[model samples]
Target: MPAPRVSVRTRIFELEMVLAGAQPPVRRRVQVPGEIDLAVLHEVVQSAMGWTNSHLHEFEIAGRRYGIPDPDWPSQDVVDETKGKLFRLVEQGDRFGYVYDFGDNWTHEITVEKITGAEPGVRYPRCVSGEGACPPEDVGGIWGYEEFQAVMADPAHPDHDERLEWARGSFDPHRFDLDETDRALQWLAWRPLAPVS
Candidate 1:
């Protein structure tokens, strides 16, 4: 008998999450398995981009909203994100939107660059490359980020010292380490969630 083909289809997704309205474009490239759920996708993004994942997030694609549906807001159109698989809902060349921190309105433009099979012995959901540092949480969005940058650049500015202190000395808006990001992602992908007793 011929060897049966294993149906494990690993997806090599070159997903780029670009912060909306960010000049020079803060972005990251990640590869995740196609069978991953939107919940896992969210975790991968958070890990890859250095986000703390401290706020609500939602994914919008093809006019459908996917997120943890709120029972309090019964009329909202969000579906449970944990139920959908990436390969079933998306494909290469498709574009989508991910909104994190609704108050700050941190919008990310997510793009699917490529889709391919998984490699043997290689871990899934890893950050391949990226550029630019993520904005601090609750920094008041793009305009605020620009103001923060200005303050950081000019020591003579009246609020320079205060802003510097606020930012914890210096802030590099262009630093990215793929290895570090992948390391952080270990908690998100490699380990299984602890089952409830």
Candidate 2:
């Protein structure tokens, strides 16, 4: 059978001054109803940083960082990777970054084959901007497997039809299958870091 459809939604919530002495004070939140599209997430982050695909820079996700190389600051892997792709330098700081292959067919949706440190169940509603300051939240119990599957099946679901079509037309079941989904869950299931590493 073909892989089930995956529905993902992006919603932004605005926060105002609810009370005084609040540490965060005010903030806007983005919520995804289901699994997040890391590629789309990456695009949102880059846009917030005032960068575009044409511009190159090193960035970090999870705990790892990668980007275009500079003579002053260099990463051998990044330099080698960007040989043909033009990129600009990105300053060091706390941020989330992601990289994925969309495959040869341009119509294919990019599958998040690798994620830096974003684990399943880890909440990153505020991290939508890629700033590292947003502490991860616990989303483990927010939705169950049955709920997720239902969302995928619902035609009214925001990403249901689109993600399903993408999967049917672009995804290679043999290469990207149920195992990949399980991996994503495994990552999300990890708890936030404690005081010590």
Write candidate 1's Cα lDDT for 1-197 as tens digits: 43112234445677878889976568888887777789989988888888899999999989999999999997998999999888898899999999998988889999999987656555667788888888877788888888888888898999999988888988888877778888987765542223335
Whole-model Cα lDDT per candidate? 0.81, 0.29
Query: How many clashes (backbone N, Cα, C below 3 Å) per candidate?
Result: 1, 9
**lDDT: worst 10-residue window of model 1:** 1-10
- How well is each residue in 24-132 modelled by candidate 2, as lDDT tens digits? 2212123221233333334433332222344343333344444445576564544332232111222122233333221211111112222233334333332231111
